[model samples]
Target chain A: MALLDVRDLSVTFSDHHGRRRVVDGLSYSLDAGGSLAIVGESGSGKTQSALALMGLCGPTADVGGSVRLDGRELLGLPWPALQQIRGQRIAMVFQDPMTSLNPYRRIGGQMTEMLTLRKGLSADAARTECLEMLEAVQIGDPSNRFTQFPHELSGGIRQRVMIAIALLGRPDLLVADEPTTALDVTVQAQILRLLADLRRAMGMATLLITHDLGLVAGLCDEVLVMYAGRPAEQGPVDDVFARSLHPYTRGLLHSVPRLGRDPGRAPPARLQAITGSPPAAGDAGPGCAFAPRCAYRFGPCDEKQPEFAAVAGSRRVACHLESPP
Target chain B: MTLLGVEDIDVVYPGRSRKDMPVRAVDGVSLTVDAGQTLGIVGESGCGKSSLARALIGLAPLSRGEFRLGDSIVRAGERRWPRRLREEIQMVFQDPVSALDPRMPAWQIVAEPLAIHRPELNAGQRRERSMAMLDRVGLTADLAMRYPHQFSGGQCQRIAIARALVVEPRLLICDEAVSALDVSVQAQIVNLLAGLQDELDLAILFISHDLAVVHHLSQRVAVMYLGQVVESGTREQVYGLPAHPYTRALLAAIPDPARLELPAVLDGEVPSPTDPPGGCRFRTRCPHAIALCAKSPPPAVAVNGHHAACHRRDELTRPAPG
Candidate 1:
């Protein structure tokens, strides 16, 4: 069995407006030491889905469906049971490192606190493990960094610290939400490399949630493309990127300016911009959510919502056009 | 002729105390942008690209050097900008939502420039011009009555672009303007800016950390590292054959799935501008740094009509060993 298996995962929130579903009927699985990327733009519920998996979604959100790790169901567990599993079996690294970390506490204090409380390590032993993990994340002079507060470190360093803390628990799975979005291109490369290396070294499964397709290509083995509270497509990263059946995926690929294009030749004067914006949650009517902006959208796309079905080997697309003739 | 000429411009922020060091955010940078030309400045965070953009439009005071817009000249330490000079140079910032006034309607925000620069026009005339500018930027006439919060990120950027170009400024400085936007929306705005550049013959100082975006719009490119222009050349010259190690590193760092290979990551982070290393500022992180790199600042060497400030420019640019 895979290390992490999720089926029919759904998340909804009830506000003054109405009960709006943010994630709906999403299913995927990741084997031991495998990596999966949840790719989407803003309001795509990719982040919310990951939050649901971690049991970190706040009181406002209503999450459903089965989340199993090591043949054990996680959904609807008590607060204490969930807490025991969190940061111990399944760890998470958030997008913004500054806000996630405490400004007042030194790096050593914050990391050691988690270790002592969760792993039942002594203060001295936790300190030693913290230093080792810091060095493992390629933070130079871990000893000095231990004494410094979060404010004293750079964005990249703080992110590395977050990764080290996540790994200190020796978790089986790691969920990173837009880990490199706040960083520069060079720094982003470093962080991605660090994550890839650590995942390989520790034999851990990773669920990387990001908007950048380029990131998905390098770091992930499988990909789940989300749009407007639903899974638009899911498959091996190479297959999804190379032969994307969904119009949204194709539009996303065409939108980004790539570096590999020949500098000597003139680039396409205008990019294939996806006209109109993504629909607001629950604003997507009974029909297909992407029908409004989809270039290849047809009669059925507007009349009825498409269901996620197997299209090719290990690939599933939620598009009416993907149906075999 | 160059519509905008910047010579050895330096912007320095004063120290907090006598013991503290003042930061030289932009140091001895020189470049030019001709009429209807786009000069893209590419750099990482804290490399002073935004600082340089601010200095060009007189938002930040230059500690030294000079700038010329057409025939008019503005020297360093000039606190007050003449109205004519101010009207000729406009800027579009990165954050579209925060850059605009939330309380004001979209038309009012776009027409505010006319209110400041072209007061001779009546309120009705200003409104017409604002609506026309809005239409040109792809925003419909109906959006004119809406406020910033009502518009999407891409639409807000269009409004911002409309506001900047309403005055028909000789030069437009976009400091990471499309960085906050999504990939699809970013392309739309890029195309919109390109179209406006052709229509108005406006010189653009395009500052961004994204190499691909810069290459898409720029006629010429300048690569900044630690408050200095490490390399500057025509788009083809710089992008096709980068000379400076820093520039090469920046290009190589772009996440290209087509390439599908790990980038040659730089060794260390950018040093604080306040206490930058002597000689080459990039020596700390440069893979090609040698003993000579730490001794003296690298001279700008000219090759194939391009300039790169690196002691080992030739060696770095040489063909790789078989």
Candidate 2:
């Protein structure tokens, strides 16, 4: 069995706006040492996917479907039972390190506490290993950094600290949601390098959730492009990037301002902005969700939902046009 | 005659709280732009790009030196700008969501600048003119009735662009205008800005942290560091063939999937602005820091028309201190 397997996982919520399901029928698997990146726009439900895993989804998140870790069922596991798996077996590094880390606690204290609680190591031993882990993440002067609070460090240092904290106990799976978004351009490169290194060194399977395809193009092995709480396309990074089967994925990749492309020549951009807004949850009634904004939608796309079947060249797209491949 | 002549314009942020130290936000920056040319200002965050933009548009008071919009000097406490000056210059902020009045519709937001600049216009004329300006930014006339919140990040930016252009300003100061938008949206906005710039014949003081975006858009580039122009040159000269170490570092730092890693020249956090290093401010971090660096600030080492503040100008022309 794979290290972590999520089968038809769905997440819903109820508020003043009625029942809103953020994540619907999401399924992916990862072996012991693998990296999968889920890329999407702001409201494309990438963050919720990470939250769904490790049982971090809040009370309002009405979850259904199976979440398996090392062949063990986790869907309806009690909070106490799930808590044991979370942070110990699987860890998460949130987007913003400034808010994720406790400002009051010292880095050493936070790192040591996790080691002591999860792995039952002595305080002294935990401190030693944490300092070693900090070094592994390429944090300078790890001994001094241990005593420093979250606020004392720069944005990059703090993120490295967050990564170190996540890797303290060496969890089997790691879910990093836009870990480098808040960092400066220079620091972003450093943090990404660290994540890539540690993933290889520690033999940890990782799920990197971010918006920047450029970052994923270099770092991630497999790519999942999500749209309106569902995966629109899934395949190897090079394959998906080279031949984006879905129109939305192609539009997203072209939209990003890469190093090339003269900014001066104002070409009348051909953006497939999907004429309307994202379809709301429970609104995907019997038809393709993307049909509303799809530029090339024909009669068949609007009438029925498309299957997420395999396409040619080992790729899969959840669109009617590419379903036959 | 220079269209906009600013020489040695300095802005010092006097410490408000007792504990905080005074910060020299922008210091001794001098440049002149012809009436119909765009000058792109590129720098890292906290490099005083916004402060320079604020001074150029007469929003902030100059602590020292001179600022002239044509022949007239911009004086302190003249916050209520004169009609002729107000109509000629306008500023667009980074976040259109907060910069624009959310309670009012798009037409009213664009009309606010029109009313301020051309008070003589009646409500009917304002409405007509605002819709006309909206069309220039590639926005539909129907969007005039919708609120800013209803639009996407890109559309909200178009509304902001319309607001800036509605006054028919000669110079538009865009402070990270498209930085917040998505990449695809950024290209659209960039296209819109270019079309408007050409049609209206306006000068632009484009400010941004992203070097690649600046390289893509700007005609001429000026790199700033700790409230001063560390380097200035033509777009190809500055971005393609960089003069200053800081400029090269800024360009190298931007993530480019197309280009593999170049020899990186910078490391560590941005030095604190409050207590910037004495003499050459960048010396503390500059890889080529020597004994002379702590003694005096480096003068602008001249290129053909370009300039960079570095002691070892000869070294920059070489392999750039690998």
Candidate 3:
């Protein structure tokens, strides 16, 4: 069985404006030691989809569909059961390290406490294991870092500490949401390298959530492009990037600024910018969510939604267009 | 014509306590922006890109050095800016939403600059000019009556651009202006800025951490590290043939979809700016450091104005034979 399998997942919330489905009909699977990336802009419900799988949704949120981990249905699991699976079977690292980590507690205390409580290890053993984990994450001086608080460390170090904390349980699946978004460019590269190393060394599956398509190419094996709470395209990263079938996917690929292959003195060519912004959440019109922004949008694009079905060359795309332009 | 010429400049912030050392945010950085040109300043956080921009705009304390815009010259210890200089240089901040006042309508927000800078113009004329600027930035006249909260992130950025350009500034300093925006929206704004610059013949100082965007928008690029310009060259010279080790590492670090292989990763965080490394600020983290790199600072190695501050600039960046 796949390590993680999610089918037709949907997460909705109730407010004064009525129910709004932030994550709709999301489906994908990942095997052990594999890496999958969910790419989308903000408000596309990429984060919320991961939250739903982990049973971390708010009280007002209603999550439907099946979330199976190792053939076990995780959706609607009791709080106690979900808590047992959270840090053990699956772990999550957020975008911001300062807010996610406890500022009042020392790094040693926060890290060791989890091992002692969950793994039933002794104080000395827990401390030893945590120090080893920190070293594994490439912290130059783990002992000193253990005594310091989150504020004392740099942004890159704090993020490493967060990853170390998540690894305490030796989770089978790691859901990292924008892991390097808040970091500097050089630091971002370092963290990504660390994650890739850890994934290979520990043989853990990774579900990376980020807005940068460039990031997906180097680290992730598979990519799922989400738009307005729906999967627009899904396939191996190389194939999808080479020949994107969906108009939205094509537009996004063309829009991002890339360093030229051979630099020249000529002015930069204008980017192929999409016309409009993403639709407001739950503002669906029983049609394609990307119709308005799509350049190759046709008659049926506004009247009916396209099915997310498999196409040639081992890819699943949701668009009226049959093949690459 | 040299629209903006910034000589060796420094920005120092006093320490909080007696024992604490003052933070030297920007140290001895020099560059020039010609008329109708875009000069991109690329750096990591706390590298003093923003501090340099703030220094140029007269917001931060310029501890030393000087800068001249057109015919006006402002030196160290000159706290006040002349009225003409202020009108000639304007800035657009990082966050589009917070950069604008929520209470003010779109037209009013754009007209606020005109009210202060061009006092002779009546309110009607100010509104007319503001609306025209808005239209040029891709915002409609109908949206002009609405407040900032009513607009989307892209629209808010357009409004911000409209406001910055309404005063007809000769130099526009965009400090990570598109960093807060999404990719599609960022492209739109970039195109808008290009068009506007051509129309007005404005000289722009674009500061951003995103290398790809910097390469796209800039004619000349300056790579800053620990408040110093490590490399300055044309976009081709900098992006295609990076000489400084820091610049090379930075460009290599970016994950490019076109190139799927994981590039070299830079190790260690930036050293504190308060007490930077004595010889070279980046030598502590650079991969090609030797004893001399830790003893004295590297001198500028120049080739047709494309220069890099590195001891082994030529030896390290020799083009591989085909």
**RMSD vs true structure, all candidates:** 1.4, 3.3, 1.1
Q: Residues B1-322, candidate 2, lDDT per residue (tens digit)? A: 3577778878888888998898888878987766777788877677788988887666666677766776567754456555577677788888878888889999898888777678899999999999988887877878889998888887888888888888888888899998876654676777677767777878888888777667656777888898899889787778767767777676666665443332243677678788888888888767777888899999987779888888876665676355
Give candidate 1 misplaced runs (Cα > 4 Å). A322-325
lDDT of 2 by residue, A284-311 (tens): 6567777776777888887876766677
Q: Which residue window of length 10 is worst by lDDT in model 1 chain B? A: B256-265
Residue A292, candidate 1: C-alpha displacement in angstroms: 0.9
Top candidate on DockQ is 3
- Candidate 1 residue B283 C-alpha distance from true site, Å: 0.8
Q: Looking only at chain A, give the TM-score of model 2 against the true structure.
A: 0.92
What TM-score does chain B get in every candidate? 0.97, 0.93, 0.98
lDDT of 1: 0.89
Residue A304, candidate 1: Cα error in Å is: 1.5
Off by over 4 Å in 2: A261-295, A322-325, B75-83, B259-265, B288-291, B319-322
Q: How well does candidate 2 score on lDDT at residue B114?
A: 70
Q: Is candidate 1 or candidate 3 better by DockQ?
A: 3
Q: Go through the candidates in order and give each one's DockQ.
A: 0.66, 0.35, 0.70
What are the per-residue Cα lDDT tens digits for candidate 3 across B1-322?
Answer: 8889999999999999999999999999889999999999999999999999999888998989999998999999986777899889999999999999999999999999999999999989999999999989988889999999999898999999899899999999999999998877888888888889999999999999999888889999999999999999999889888889999999988888877877579989899998899887789999999888989998777898998999878778887789
| Candidate 3 residue lDDT tens string, A60-133 | 99999999999999998999999889989999999999999999999999999988998899999999999999
Ranking by TM-score: 3, 1, 2
Candidate 1 lDDT tens digits, B163-209: 99999899999999999987767878888888888888888999999
Better of 1 and 3 by lDDT: 3
